[model samples]
Target chain A: MNKKSMYGRTARKIGCYAALLILAVIFMFPLYWFFLNSFKSYEQLFQFPPKFWVWPFRLVNYLEAYMYPAFDFGQMMKNSAIITITSVIGAVLSSSVVAFGFSRIRWRGRDQVFVLVILTMIIPTEIVLTPLYLIYSKLGLLNTWFPVIAPFFFAKPFYTFMLRQSMMGIPVEMDESAIVDGCNVWQRFTHIILPQVKPTVLAVVIMAMQDQWNNYLEPLIFINSNSKQTISVGLTFFSGMNATEWNLVFAGAVMVALPILIIFVFFQKYFIQGVVVSGVKG
Target chain B: MKKYTVKEKRAIRQGLLFISPWLAGVIGFTLIPLLLAFGISLTDYNFLTKPRFVGLENYITMFAKDPLIWKSLGITFLYAIISVPLQLVFGFLLANLLNQKLKGIVAFRTLFYAPCLVAVVSSTLLWKQMLETEFGIINYLLGLIGIGKVSWLGQTGTIIASVVFISLWQSGKMIIINLSGLQAIPTAYYEAADLDGCSRWRQVFYITLPMMSPTIFMNLLIGLIGAFKTFTQIKILTDGGPSNASLVYMLYIYKTAFTNYKLGYANAMSILLFVIVGILTVFVFRTSNKWVHYGSE
Candidate 1:
């Protein structure tokens, strides 16, 4: 009976591993297929029984796609970098400060204002999309990065709420001790709240970067010029022109996705943490 | 009211100062634009032309005249209703599977999430290519099984399903949320159940599931909201193609606003959508007390 129970336990363990391994392969297949296809020649892309592997990888596809004259891929990458970096810095600074007020500071009508902040999240962006577009055009901000990047500097609701939830967890006594030392609010905030919630700050930064870097619709609508276009928008234009050219499409896709994938790999902890928290809250 | 102390007054002033950016944002972005959307819905104005006040004409046309409004709403509602719950279930199950205490499971979890790291445009395009009738991998696989080439994107019936399938590739966020929720379930309950000679399936049914109800409820609401707003995938993949079989509400609002340049009409439609989503969200929250197990009991 002991031997039979031991056998059953071993079978269960092996079965669990096998199941997980199969699911992993199935989950990874699309990406694996995509990466492999990016290296194939244009002629080979159409062939049936698709090449599971390619010999002498056509590294030139990356070169051709990047320097492809139509879309100005390099310029678009620069544009994406500028927009993403500015937005990340803006989100981190403004969200943290605003969250600090909501969590650490005591004041009249504070919870009511915090409730208002949460309400802003419920309203869809469509309600604001047309008016903002019209207003931006009136302000002569159309086709400029201002319309896209400026939203983050204004303490975006989702990020503020996430950071606020994290901040409220730290004991108020941390602030009281600093307050007794005659440290002003800013000093206490910087020395006390910010340092304690370092992981969340990092999470906010990565989330901001991911959001801005991958944003397609904002750029597509606001920025008209090819030179000013972000990579996500630029790739759409690339494939639009070269719909039949599978090789270039795959190459362009790899280029746009590689940087974020690399960042995600190095900072898996931050990505998962941010995703979990933001997913729950957002 | 009682007079404020010096510290009380100081705290109020400092709090307002710190949150001034959010105050500006609420006024500039939310309140002002919401007022504008309502005002615009009553007027007939294009981008280039001066606003001509047409009292209730946009709303009137939307409610009584437009031929495509109901159809598009149906498609959008169907898409959200079917896809959100489907994604929630699959994501939860995947999370449960991954929640096992095996070695190197974190690596497996990362692999599942890797698809989400690819930006929307790139992933959509890859899926589009794979769904191509002749040269695509999806059809090639079906052909190997003695089935004919199916036009995944070109057909009216399959377009919505195709987008829904494409979306599952990025269910990593949902999985992560559910996985975290599962981890937060105290192990002691399961330990007690094991001591009681409960079967593994029984332990899951009684202990694991009740603990997961809140997370599932949250995902249900958020997923529905998100599915309601899905645009990039649809616009890139099919663009509401094959006789508008898959034209979602947001896509129509977009086409009306930017493509057709009917700003007032689109604003009216957006207000309509806002009402639908707002009512749905409130209804979900109100009903939550019935089903969501917050562990307080």
Candidate 2:
């Protein structure tokens, strides 16, 4: 283009970079600060000017955090892993099966039931919290992991809808070809549709795992025993008990947050794509 | 009416079989609990005693006598109003920036999006420390500029603002969604705008904004609902504290049910919350047609 427009373009690019740099720093500051403080001693942590960097990194903070007397961080991590893995597997399998039924079959009431599935998305969980709690209590499943993990086996509407939408985009001819090869509905679903929607299934798996890992309120309410708590709830109680020790608190926070962060970093493409699909489709 | 053949009957049966788990879940977990919640809302159950049918007594008390309900609702509305738009604007602006072709853009995007992955409990606890009046880095930085330290979570005036600030800090998901919307806009439109000698500002106002309206609407709806349902952060950070100044609705219901053991009253609060959210969602959907542009239409 013209010289004036070229200069304007250059200036705009520079300005954009500047703005982005500032925003990036602002966004990353909390995590950075948290990490920096995690290694600081109590005196260093409470220093008036707030030391930008710890003199000698106290890795013992992590050790203390892990061995905190009030709650066992190792046990908490195990509980979190168990809950997250089981729930993700349950949600993925159940949601995919239900999605296949909705998208692949032409039942009389299919559309009507799918509409009900969509409607469930808008109903806030608060409405069912009390009664669900009572039902679990009545069933004598209150303190167990059943309350947290069992619901996923039933199929969450949001994940079901997401999977169904993606499954619908898979060509019908694949299922038809499978049927011609003497495949029943279940075989076709397993052999054709499941393989086709593997990417979306992976995305759903990661999202479900993230949700289960980060879930707080459910664990807080249902799993009252300190030993049974997930990382999220356990960390909160840890922080409360060690409120004065900022180093331990930050250490516990880091431990609680690290796995999800690692997952996001490694699987960012799927994560970003999942966010886009959900946003656009909704 | 056409009669179904045997083949069609099998397909129907198989379909039902596939979806049976969901049906069972809906019956046992969702629908039954919802009906039971409505029933409990009309009673005086405290989890320790049998639910005595008081017949709308909880709702009546909430409406007529309980002032915290109104105050908490007002606080929640304020939180939603301020935080949703703030997040939307920040997300939109950042998305526009990230849409540019640049080196290391992916790294920048990841950095910005990382906060969204942080667990709410941890993030709240981290922020609680960072906003501490005496030892917080925030006040330390303010002190450097000759500004006095402010009790971010302590003061009534600053409590909501602090909550909003922390919420906005995790606007990464919104940014990702907005970036997708931005990238989805056809580049041909911008090229055409350039051919017509349109200014960048005019192009954004006329073309980009309209094209992105649907995405914006989606973000707005999600943001509104999310802000209203905010619990873990407030509960961890302030515990609706410093005189209940930051008591959001969900925290109120949670405290009422769990801490006070007033299950019936909490259910009443929950039913009210559900209706309010439903109405707000319908209102948005109704208004969306006017402003939310679809490319096909």
Top candidate (lDDT): 2
TM-score of chain B of 1: 0.93
Compare the candidates by DockQ and give the number of the best one: 2
Task: Give the DockQ (2 decimals) of all models.
Answer: 0.57, 0.60
Question: Over the stretch A122-219, how does candidate 2's per-residue lDDT look in tens digits?
Answer: 67775688899999999999989999998889988877877887787777888888888999888888988888777678778877887899898888
Model 1, B206-290: lDDT tens digits are: 9887888877886787788788888899898889876887788899999999999998899999889888888998898899888
Each model's backbone clash number:
0, 0
Per-residue C-alpha lDDT of model 1 across residues A61-115, encoded as one tens digit per residue = 9998898878789999999999999999999999999999998998998988897
Candidate whose TM-score is highest: 1
B7-104, model 2: which lDDT tens digit per residue?
A: 88887998999988889988988889988999999999999888999997999999999999999999899888888889888888888998888878
Candidate 2: which stretches are off by over 4 Å?
A1-8, A104-115, A171-183, A239-243, A277-279, B1-20
